[model samples]
Structures are given as C-alpha cells and as structure tokens.
Target: MTSIAPPRLPEPAPAGAAPPTSAPVLRMRGVTRVHGGGATQVVALRGLDLVVYPGELVAVMGPSGSGKSTLLTLAGGLDVATSGEVFVDGTALGRLSTKALAALRRRSLGYVFQDLNLVPALTAAENVALPRELDGVATRKAYREAVAALTEVGVAELADRFPDQMSGGQQQRVAIARALVGPRRLVLADEPTGALDSATSGEVMRVLRARCDAGAAGLLVTHEARHAGWADRVVFLRDGMVVDSTGEPSTPESLLDGDGGSTAGGAER
Candidate 1:
C-alpha cells in the first residue's frame, strides 16, 4: 500500500531571509472601544495591540462577542477607538480628519464583510468601481481597474451581472473584487467565508492569501480552524482582550485533523 505525505506548510518567514525594514501596514497600540455610556457601557476591545506587515496574513479567532468583529471594524476605520491608536501605512487614523480618513479608506484600505454587500441595482463591475469613482477617479479609469480586479479574483465574466443574477459564492467573489479594486495596503475581512460551502470557502481563502503574498497585509476573522490555517499567525481574543497568539504550525494539515490550537474563551481549536 502506498502512503501519501502531508503537504508542507509555508514558513512564517522565509528561511534565512532578512527581516522586514518597513513599518507594519497595520498597527494597533493599546486600542480600546466602548459602546453606550453609564450603565449600558460595553467594552468591545480592551487594550489590544496587534501588527500586520506586508506579505502577511493574520487570523483573528474568537467566539461571538469576543471582539473579533470589533477589531476588524477599528482596523478598517469603520469605527474609532475609545482610546489608543490605529495606524495604517504609517498614518495615524485618529489624527486624520473625517474627510481625510474617508479618503484614506477609499484609497488605501479594503474591507470584506460576511454579508457580501454588493448593491442590488448596480452590476458587479459598477459596484466595484463605485469606490474609485467616489474617490474622484475618472469613470473610465475606475471601470478599467474594476475589471482588472474582478479578473484577479476570477469573477471577470460576471462583471456585468447584477447581484441578484449571481450565486452566493459569485456575489462573495464580486464583493472581494470590490474590496481589492484600488491600491489597497490593508485588507480587513470579517468572516468572509462564513456563508460559503467548504469548497467555495477554500477558494476565498486562496484569493486572500494570494493578495497578502502580493504585498498587501490581511487581517481575517474566522472561527473555522481550516480557514485559520491559511493565515501566518492566529490571534485569540476573549473578554475583549488578546489572550494568545501563535505562528501557524509546520503541518497545517494537522490543524484540520483535530490538532488545531486553542483560542481564548475556549471557542476555537
């Protein structure tokens, strides 16, 4: 009988490679976020510190309400921190004015949500081009970039289809293309594969991983060990705080075969 060997995991950093000299693409220092006030105050993140460098993908894993989504929102500039700082590409998010922050988000960041929020009325290409157009790029230029992005994510043929005309996986791919349309330095994904089947989910992970390898920084929020295996590192959060983080194992195949590591709050393993 012949035995197949398990696939080898990629090194966290290439063997004997020089350390990175550039600043992290995304950085969070002593970040915290609170909701409501007085009796209703709820802490979403508590003094979390994280950094994701170019060519790296970090997975944030925790139970529901463990602040995984909160971390992504703050990192993406969708929500402000109550205290502490978030920096993207060396610019402090807190220091940027509202307009400047909006501009920065449009030009430098990409966000993917579990809901796959493509506009129902717009075709896939138009939806992907909207951000570029809103950022003041010419319509032709934006649409050209949109087509290129869709092609990168393997969805170019569906560029003219409306949201309702595609399958869930296809819509999700379009959403990913929209996130990746511009010269984004950071990609923040919140359960990007939560709604897809196993095969489709794997495909999405491959796209995200490829983007990171191509010099973008990625922060992925996922509960599945298989998905987390795609990341270079896994951060575990509980009670709004990071309790553990570790490099991906040498044998990623083991992670999915029940040898996956644990996360904070006992939710992931």
Candidate 2:
C-alpha cells in the first residue's frame, strides 16, 4: 500500500529579510486575561498583540507582576485569554476542543518551565520521550528521538541517569531536550537559565539560539539583559502591554544603556 504524505505548511521568511507574507507560527491579537471577580479582579494581560515567526527568538522582559509569565502561559495554551485570540501555527486556540488543544500541545508546542519539572522516576531519555509517548508514538521510536534530542543538547552521556543523579545544569539541559524533541514548532521558555551558573546559562542560551536558527520559533522570558541579548528582538512589557520593541535604529547597545531609544522599560532591568 502507498503511504499518504502529510500536508505541507508554508515556510517562514529568511532571517534579516523583510517580514514574511506567510502566517506567523504564533500570533496574539488583542489578548487579555483577567483573574477573579469584580471585587478582586486582576488583569494579567490587557489588549496585547504579538507575533513570533519561525526561525525567530523573541525575548520578553519586564518587572515582576508585569504579565511576562501570563503572556507565556496564554501563548502555550495552558491558560485561556479573557478576550481576543491566540493562534499557534495558524490554528486558533480558542476554537479547539479541550482534547484537540491537548493534542496540539503535545505534538506542536514545547515548554520549559523555570523549575525544570523532570520526573524523578524517569531517566533523562525517558523524560524526553514522555510527550511523544503521550502523543501515541511507539516506545522505541520515542526513545530514539529522545536520544537524538539529548545529543543535540550535549547530554547524551546522561540519558540513562535519573533526575536526582544529575546537577541542576544537567537537569536543565535534559528539560531543554524534552522541549525541543519531536516536531514542536513553538518553544516557550520561562527563565530557563534562572538556576544555572553564568557559564551554564550562556550554554543554554546558545542551545536555544541554535534551535531557533534551525527553524523553530522561540519565546523566552528573561530579566537579565545579557540573556535577552541572544534574542533577535527584545519586547518590553509593562502592566500587560507592549511598551516597546527593539529594531534597526535602536541598537542593542542603546537598549542596554536605558537610553531614550526603542528600549524603554525592560531593557534597563
């Protein structure tokens, strides 16, 4: 029997060129998320619009309670927006059923939490394979893919070790392997380097940068200017709104200086 081929998605524009006419891998339009009732309402995000394209890594920086994590959660489909819309790979998140949403997440989205949520019982390879297993891939195939991802993140030697057997940096590398495994089109990382030393943090950023360079769209939330420098564009969020973004006229140097250029709020922090 002849195997049927899957449908092909449009490719992203090349880096440093004009914006692509194709749809973005991730898109948020007038997104808002409010918590609690009238007496205790807190708006986590308000009328936010953003887009992350393939081969692009966008850094988000802001002070505490500035909706950085909220925006990430919304983009990853872990939380619903109070209004407006979020689309991942051209699929509107709000329109999908719970099951469909879960499936999409398992197959298309990868998230690396700050805490590095690796299971104690599972080895590194097994942990990385879990998502693919949940998505119905065969056990052997998942493990093979897991090994490949582990090698990509420079942790193949630790693939058989459990989480407790590794250092914090090693565990974080395993977590990144899990996130980048499979055909995930969007990778969302929340302070992925928060627990590592300076060298380890730089290594992780290099890995993330290489992943984006290889065609995945990345959204990273970080407070450190050094970390955000790895991103192609830095987005500053304040009180759930995009206060500024870095572009041609506003160099990363100016942004770091907290000058009156495109880098206004988060760049200084």
Candidate 3:
C-alpha cells in the first residue's frame, strides 16, 4: 500500500526574529485634511502625528466624521493630505512625482476597504491576482501567488468562488489574501470586520494578527471594540487627532470596553 504524504507545513519564522519594530513603516506628521478651501473649508485632520512600525498591528478608532477614513486614505496614499506630510518608509510623499508615487504605492502598500472592493464577476483567485495582473506578471505566476496567499489566510478552497458565493467572513478573508498576496510592506484595512458576526470577526482578527506577526505592518481603522484586541496598540482619534493611545496587547478582555476612550477631546495634537 502506498503511504500518503503529510501536508506541508507553513514556513517557520526565523529563530531570532527582527525587532518587533524599527523605523516606522509609515509616518504622518502634522497631517491636516480639509474639505473645502476658504469660506467652505473644514479641517478634517488637525496637524496629527501617526507612526506605524514594522510587525505592528495598530487600530484607529473614532466617531464617524472624525476623519478616521481620511487618515487611513492619507496614510495609504489614496488621498493626499492638505498640509504637512506623510512618509512611507521615509519617502516623503510630497517628494515623489505622480507616477513615482503610484509605483511606490504598488511596491509597498496594500489596502482593504469596508466594501472589500472586489469584482463580482471574477473568481476569488482572479480577484486576488488583480494587482499582479496590473503589474504585467505572467497569468500563471500571478495565480500561483494568489493561491499561496489564499492558503496562508486559510481560504484556498474558496479560490474559485465568486464574491457573491462567499459569506461575509470569507469575503473579508479573500480581501486580506489579496492585500498581502504581493510583496506588501504595509497593510491598511478600513473596518475589515465591520460586517462580520462576533465569532467570524474573532477569526478574521486572528488572521490579521498572524500576518503582522509574520513581519507585515497593519493599520486597521475600525469602530468595533472587540476587533481592537487584535492589535498591539490601539490609538483613539477624536475630531481628527490621536487623542490617546495604548499598548494593551491582544486579548478578548482588552476589547471589552466598546466605548474606547473619553468623549471629551483632550490633548488631540
């Protein structure tokens, strides 16, 4: 009788891991976002400072309209800050040309949205390989990478399923697989588990934490207190500023306080 081979194991991390943090993966200094100029102008971010280090999982929390989305977009280079500067790996965004910036973003950044922004018509593998396809990678190679990414996120079985065929948790996992499929250095997720049920949200957060532990930096923008427990740090934003931050570490209990911070905005700058 032929013996069946055992399943291959995931790659083990190096014995001596890199410092959990180093030069920040992304930095924003005195960042400010404005809605309209002059009379109609409204400041979204009021000269805020943010830094995310390698292997760090940081969560951003704020009331709606507090500029949480704007801050995430600015950090991901999806939206430009109206004033101050943002740096991804020390490359100040203001210094790069549009084409250069686009290239920089593709090389180092990955983003997941509340919508997941996946194509309904495409299969999960195809959807995950979109970035690789855009970069002109060979189809076979791109799909191969996509499959590996899916496996890492425990969604390889769903590779052929369309978005509509997957559950909300499965869809979010696929989105995460897509984000990290490439050689991503920074991962930005905007309320990734917002739509998931309690049990599923816990699973998704574990996946995210595992990714960050494996060397990728993650910035999660979320309102759910339970989800915050997945991060190494939780930063509270109010009226467009990081009013307070805590390195509470990840645990079910840390997430118990659904109301994360003081309502009175203080020391926002």
Candidate 4:
C-alpha cells in the first residue's frame, strides 16, 4: 500500500466531543428506534448494545427488517434513537446541536449506502473530493487527497471517469474512496455489495478489510454470509436485537459450511 499522509485534524472537535485517542470509535447503549405512533407503531430496534473499537471491523448479518439498516442510521447520527444513547468517539450524539452533529460527521465519519449514491454529474475524483471540499479543504488539496484515496482503493486511474462510464464495481470503489478520503476514522457500510456479483463483492470487502486493518473502525451490514467472512467478528440480529455473535474471524468456507448455529444470546466459536 502506498503511504498516505495522516488525516489533518479538523477545527477543534465541538465542545463535549471526545479526543481522538478514545478507544471505541462507536458505542450504542440500549438503543431503540420506533416508527409511527398509536396502533401503527413499529419497533425497528430494541435495546441494542454495540461497541466498535479502532482497527476492528464488525459485520452485521440478518434477514430483511432485522434492523440492520436502522442500526447504521442511528450510529451515523442520521436518525435519533427513540431511547438510550449513542456515542461516537465517546461524545453522546443526542447532546449535540444539529450544527455540532454535522461537524462531527464531516470530520470523523464516513458512510456508504446500499445505493452507492455518487453524484452523476461529477467525475470520480470530484465525487471523492466533495466531502473534503464541504469541510473547507482547499480544492487542490482535496483533489490530491481524492487521488490518494482512489489509489488506496486501486481506482486512481478512474478518477476522471464519470459514474455512467464506470462499471458497477468501479462506481462502488469510487464511493468508498469518497467515504475514506481525508481524516475520517470510522466507516459505516450498509449493504455496500448489494449491486455487485460475488467476485466484485469480494473485491469491495477486501478494500473494507484493508481500511479497517489500517486502523479505521468499520461497521458493515451484509446479507451474504460469504461477505460477512471478511469481518473480524460477526453479529447476528433478529427482531432488532443481537441473537448471536462469532468470537473469531470466520472464513468463507466456514460461513458456508453451516449456520453459525448458536442459540439466542450465545457466542459461536
């Protein structure tokens, strides 16, 4: 891997934000997300507890409506928890004003959505540089950072290509570079491989694994067991709660051989 400069610190973290040396990048305690009201109420998550430390990649797996997406939304500060607290870098999310929360996200977080939302009108490099520009980085510096990030993901040559000119896998890589550019230390990916073939999915997973190995914390929500294999740990969710967890990193072969086969609230070795 080519050496890239460390992320430049953004303006001082908002008041109440934890210092960068804090251990866990993300922490959720007794979080719950509810939808609607009255008889139409629906509980998307129920008292979920999750913690992701630096240099770790945790994969979340579950069937549809298992609250996997909901978890990402809450963790990224996109949605508020109905109850309980969510702390990113040790600062309580609910305590921040909208402006402070936005600043935190801009400086410390990266999110890759299932749809791989790249700006259609922008070239790959421009797309990747958008976040840094939004954070007030100089155009030249942000473009340089974009190229470095694209190179890190093996897509530097695609920097000038538009989304329409790239393959789905290529576009996905660009989205990742966009998320990874600058000094962000935490990434949350929700079904990032949904549009790719098994082979391309593996490629994307490899990039995510590499990022985590390089010291960024990652939270990946994936439906494919094989895709989950790249994570350091697997968390299985059922009805908005964690049902089982894997203690060791699983391989594609082991994940395909059997269901992790743990009863509720147990760890699968």
Candidate 5:
C-alpha cells in the first residue's frame, strides 16, 4: 500500500517582505480634538502625548465619554485633531493631505472595529483578502496571503465558511486575520472582545498578545479587566488625556490597576 503524504502548511513570508526597522511606530504629542467652535466648542483632547514602540501592545482604558475614542480616531488618522501632531513611523499626520493620509492608513494601519467589519456576502478567506484586493493585488495572491494569515491566527479551516456560520470568537479572529494580511504595522482594535464571553475573550486576547510577540504593534481600546491583563502597558484616558501609565516597566500588573487606582505618570506623579 502507498503511504499518504502530509498536508502542506502555510509558510511565513520571506525577510524581504518584512517592514522596516522597529522604531517608534506611532507617536502623538500635544494632540487635541475640539468639537464645535468658539463658545459652542468643547475640548476632547488636551495636549495628549503618546508613543507606541514596535512589537508593543498598549491597552487604553477609561470610562464612557472620556475621549478614549477621540484619541484612538486621531491616532489612526480616521479623524483629525484640531491642534498638535500625530505621527506614524516618523511621518507627521498634520503634514499629509487627506488623500495622503488615506494611503498611509491603508498601507500601514490595520483596524478591528467592534462590528468585525466582515463582508456579509463573502467567505472568510475572501473577507480577509479584501484589503489586498483593494490595493490592486491579484485575486490569487491575495487569497494565498489571506490563508496564511488565517492560519497564523489558527482559523484557516474556516476559510470557506461565511460569517453567519461562525461564532463570535471565530468572526473576531477573521477580523484579525484581515488586519494582519497586508503589510500592516499598527493594529488598532476597538473593543475587539466586547461581544464574547469571558472565556472566549481570554482566547482573543491571547491571539493579540501572540501577534505583538510576532512584531506587530497593537493598540487596544477595551473596558474588560480580563483583556487588559495581557497588555504591555495601559494608558488610562480621562477627559481627553493620558491619566496614567501605572505599569512597572513591562510587567503585567504594572500595566493594569483596576477599580481606579492612583495615576502613574500625571502632573502630580
């Protein structure tokens, strides 16, 4: 009898396909977002200063309406701030035109919205390949990359399944695979596990941590304490500013202080 061969595995891209040296991948200084103008205006961000190094996973937390969303939008170039500067890989966001900003986000940033943002009509592999397709890559090449990404996230078997057929965790993994499929450097996730239960949320956070270990910089906006435990650091936002970075160096506990402890790196501390 003839022996059967083992199934093939997806391999990582060659070194030439990698991004540049790990520098300060994202930076923001004196960033401010003001809603309305003159007397009717309300300040959202007040001179916020932030930096996310490569291969780091920073967790941002705050109460509702604390300008966390504003900070995230401004950082990701989705929404512009009225004052200060936002930089991705040393290029100033304020200096770029709207079109330039769009291009920058497309090539460098990967975003995971709470909704997962999968195309309802497409299979998981197709959904993951959407970005590459938008960038004019051939369908076959994009699909291959998408499969590799899904395999990395341990969801390759779902490649042919539609979104409606998967669980919330599986859908979120698909979203992550999509975010990581292209030459993306910064992964910005907004409540990525909000829809899952505690157990599934833990699994999702584990995948994100593994991604950071594999050289992707991630910024997560989450309110869940369990999820916050996986971050390298936590930047608590309040009234549009970084109220604290309480974690000790890179230790897990230093990054997370729940139930509202004292601020770590504020004016007083």
Candidate 6:
C-alpha cells in the first residue's frame, strides 16, 4: 500500500528550511482499535499512521462508520488502541500509567466532544476553567484564562451563564473555549462546528487556526469540505483505512470548484 503524504500548506517555507519544532506534537503508528469479540467484533481502525507537527492543523474526513470519532478518541487518550502506539509530545500514551496518562491529558492535550459535554451545574467560565483548576492552576488564573478563551470565541459575555442558558451555537463556542483554555500542545476536536451558523463557524475555525499558527497542533474531524478547507491538509479515510490525502493547499473556493481535492460526503461524528 502507498503511503499518504501530508498536504502543502499555504506559503511554503523556503527550500531546505527547518520547521520551527523538530518534534511532532502527535504521532500515531500502526494503530488499530477493535471492539467486542468474535461475531460481534468491530474493527474501528487499521494500521493507521499519522503525524501532526507543531503549527499544523490536520483535518480528517470520511463517510459514516469511517472511524473519525474513534480516531479522535484514541488520539486524545480517552480510549486505548488495541495495537500500535500513540505519542504526544514525544511521550507514548501506551507507555504511561493511568495516573500519568491523566496528568498528560490535563497538561498537554485538549479535546472538544461532539456532544459539548459541559457541566450543567457550572457556569460557562467555570466549565472552561475546570480543567485548569483540576490541573492545579490557581483559581484566579484559571478564571482569567477561561474568560480569555471565551473572548476568543466571541462568548465572553456568556461567561456567567450556565450551559442551559446559552443557545446551541453559543454552547458549542463555550465547549471550544474549554478546549483552548490552558497551554495545551495538541487539540482534538470532533465536529466542533456542528452546532454553529456559518459565520460563527468561521469564527471558531479562525480561533482554532490561530492556535495552530501559534505552534499548537490540531486534529479536526469534520464532514464539511469548507470546514476542512481551513486545515493545512485533509486526510480521507474509508473502511477503517486511509484511502487518500490531498497535498495542495485547500480553500473553500477551491474545494467547491469540484476538482480542488477530496471532498467528503455522508455525515459521521
């Protein structure tokens, strides 16, 4: 099988130039995930290999049951792969103890779930600050970071409101803010814009993109081609394997041109 190469992002660096960071923020090697046993068994992934270097935003796209969500879960350390290894910031997730893995997730990784997953009892600011607080950040500092993140997503005014008090799009922005709050090195987002309008979605993407530009890596799982266009490159999956990937820089206009690159269809989250 041929290996799929990463896309060429806009403004390519001069020839022979080294990237800012020599280490990749995330690396997946021969990863496979299986659920159940015998007749009921399901293979969610198969020998998947991926690398997201610092300052890169990679988008994952595929049809229903393509294992997009499973990929995110495994990358975020929320779920373990049946085989292979997952590395974040040069540390292998499979090699870490449960407590160490949890600590790594708190200090280095951030994840935005499709379901929002906000605590109903906590206000938006509190929801965003909870991770930082749990990571031992001072309360005042965590609250400050939370408010700043909310402002980045254009939801600063909603900081005092509970999850139930905000609209779906607003809540989605809040979830995004929570993912972006601390000094995380990698962000794994699953359909982060599913609940937002086009305008709001663009804003959220801009925030995510900006974070990547600032040296953090991001893996975005989305069904919309326009959304994927914001990424540095797009990886297409099919039947638990990477079928193709685009190497050219993608733009919304180009993706809509019908021949710009791979355009994913069928919703899977």
Among the numbered candidates, top lDDT falls to 2
Please, what are the lDDT tens digits per residue for candidate 5 over residues 1-269?
99889988889333212232455577777788999999998888888777676667888899988887788888899988899988898899888998888888877898888878789999999999988888788999999999998997889999999999999889988998898787788888889887778777777777777777777778899887667767777888888887787452232332453311222336423
Q: Is candidate 4 or candidate 6 better by TM-score?
A: 6
Name the weakest run of 10 consecutive residues (lDDT summed) in model 3.
257-266
Assess each prediction's global lDDT (C-alpha) against the native.
0.83, 0.85, 0.80, 0.82, 0.79, 0.83
Q: Which regions in candidate 2 have their CA more than 4 angstroms from the true location?
A: 1-21, 248-269
Stretches of model 3 off by over 4 angstroms after superposition = 1-18, 248-269
RMSD of each: 6.8, 13.0, 10.8, 12.2, 11.4, 9.6
Clashing residue pairs for model 5: 247-254, 247-255, 248-254
Off by over 4 Å in 6: 1-19, 248-269
- The TM-score between candidate 1 and the true structure equals 0.85
* lDDT tens per residue, model 4, 4-77: 89998788432111212335677787889999999999899988877776777888999999899999999999
Global CA lDDT of candidate 4, please? 0.82
lDDT tens per residue, model 6, 10-99: 995431122334466787877899999999999999877777777778899999898888889999999999999999998999999999
> Comparing 2 and 5 by lDDT, which wins?
2
* 5 against 6, candidate with superior TM-score: 6
- Residue lDDT tens for model 3, 1-269: 99989998999543213445356677787889998888988889988777676787888888998889999899988888888899999899877899888887877888878888889999999999988888778899999999988998888999999999998789988998898887888999998877778877777788777778887888999998888867777888888887877743232222342222221134454
TM-score of each: 0.85, 0.85, 0.82, 0.83, 0.82, 0.84
